[model samples]
Target: MTKGRAALLVVAAIVFLTVGFVIGQMVQAAGAIPGTAGDPLVAQSYVEKIVGETVASLQTKLDEMQAKVDDLQEEVDALSGDTGTNKGSGKTTLPQSSNPPAQGKTVVVSGDSANIRTGPGTTYAKVTTLVKGDTATMVSEENGWYKITLQDGKEGWVANWLVEVK
Candidate 1:
């Protein structure tokens, strides 16, 4: 063969081999070798869907917990029996009585059924009846009784033997 033609043929072969090698390297780098094919967009979509579902589930659980907390707060308020205005030490205050007295003390019912009287003595009219564990604020002590206010804000008196100071 002529020298110029031989050199041209060699240069063409080199160019072909270089192009083939670059293509092969690109295919391998893209993970398309053998039986494998990679699609980055499809993998990214699957990961995004999983993260979205997890966030939604966490939000639902947080909402359920907040609802439970609100319910518990309502139950606590009901059990407290608070009138919302008497935040003072769980005690009731009463009007002054007609006899000699002590001031600013707490009194509790001492019997299973203690009479609440309109006045300070046995001869007074019966206003109501209080059971043991019932509490009141003593406005005064008269002759031998304690004048107190009921939970419902009514003023009444009870025999000293039927009530005690605390």
Candidate 2:
């Protein structure tokens, strides 16, 4: 499950467990005492102490669990390469270094209105633009983005899918 969904489930479980604890306390308080002349105050005190300790323990466990969740989220973000628009499945997938065929070549922008980003990812700002049939010199590549020099001497990166090696 996603981290968000798992976090939500943990919250829901805490709420449910809290309600159940409160209800169980109430039921226990409502019952008669074996001795002490059926004093309501004593029974209330006992139930409150038990419930308080239990809730405190539960809260501690939840805090520990939350910390674990945060650590897992960080690991996931690192594995995804932190591209906002793209996340390759990290499981059993081959790592790609660069485009073998496009490097050291002039490539034609294959897509209409391809965005030239400031960096090697679409998460970067669009420094300029390219259109279908526009030719750019491929400078380098990483993670499916190609560094290119545009016709007017502007340099930026484009999605590898947007260009064809020539």
Candidate 3:
């Protein structure tokens, strides 16, 4: 990746971690609510709401940062005359492939119930549920999440803690 892309990725990872930390603190706070010692769902819901809001806030920031990155990429593309070189990364970008299944690697769910989500973060909507022995193809990875292709060929992302590479 280019230095610019790498920097954006670092920022994204930091956002993810910060959100996780905030949710953790919120959960701790919720657990202390009076008369709710026996019911953890309240805490769960609170954490979920916090996560959702944090994700929404970060999404806007990401969009703005992405626009900047896109502008830089466009400038680079123009100067390089649309060549395959990925400037600042010292690497050549590979041409994309048509075959989806054969393109990337695969991984299997290590946990009993793994959530496959619309995006890498837990704040993203859960699109499917995978149990132990479930498998998916690797698509992309950033932060502590894995973007995967389900066995049925649908695309989604999962938390890295839930899976092991196949």
Candidate 4:
């Protein structure tokens, strides 16, 4: 072959290989999956859909947490002596006559029936009656009587002779 023709053929082969390499790379890029190691490009619509779903899930969780906080606040308000009413149960809670003693002890009524009086003496008016096996928390002692708090938080006096300290 002539030197000029051989040189022309070599240049043509180099150009053809370069074009083929470029086309092969374009085809591989077109076939690659988005967001994968082969392709890092992600579509905007796909990102928006994922972000919207995550935001919705977080909003649902936040609503549930707010409801729980509201319920707990109501309970705390009721316990802190607000309105003298239990909001959850719709019941009137009586105020404690006095704070429980640091060394309060449980006592049971040993008599057939014992009077719960407003005062320690027999002259005091009867508020209620406690029968045998009825229990109360003895707050303090007064003149042969025991000042006690009932289960319902009511305070009254009972004769010590009619109760057995537990």
RMSD per candidate (Å) reads 25.8, 26.3, 24.1, 23.5
- lDDT score, residue 51, model 1? 59
Expressed as tens digits, the lDDT of each residue in 22-78 for candidate 3 is: 999999877655534355445655655566566546644654665567667768888
Cα misplacement distance, residue 68 of candidate 4 (Å): 58
Which stretches of candidate 1 lie above 4 Å from their native place?
1-101
lDDT of 2 by residue, 45-143 (tens): 566556656654664465466556656766788886776343333322235644375466998977544767788653456686565688989888777
Worst 10 residues of 2 by lDDT: 85-94
Checking candidate 1 for backbone clashes, the offending pairs are none
Better of 1 and 4 by lDDT: 4
Model 1 lDDT per residue over 1-166, tens place: 5999999999999999999999999987877333322444455556555655665466446546645665565566668885656332222235444554467677887655576878865445678766667898888775577889888999998877767778
- Candidate 1's displacement at residue 21, Å, is 99
Q: Give the alpha carbon lDDT tens digit for every residue of 1-166 in model 4.
A: 6999999999999999999999999998788797544555777666655665665466446546655765676778877877735444432233333543333899898855677889875546678877668999989876567899999999999877778888
Comparing 1 with 2 on lDDT, the higher-scoring candidate is 2
Worst 10 residues of 1 by lDDT: 86-95
Candidate 4 residue pairs in backbone clash: none
> Model 2, which residues run further than 4 Å from truth?
1-99
> TM-scores for all candidates?
0.38, 0.42, 0.39, 0.39
lDDT of each: 0.68, 0.70, 0.69, 0.73
Candidate closest to the true structure, highest TM-score? 2
* TM-score for candidate 3, residues paired by index: 0.39
User: For candidate 1, what is the lDDT?
Assistant: 0.68
Candidate 1 matches the true fold with a TM-score of 0.38
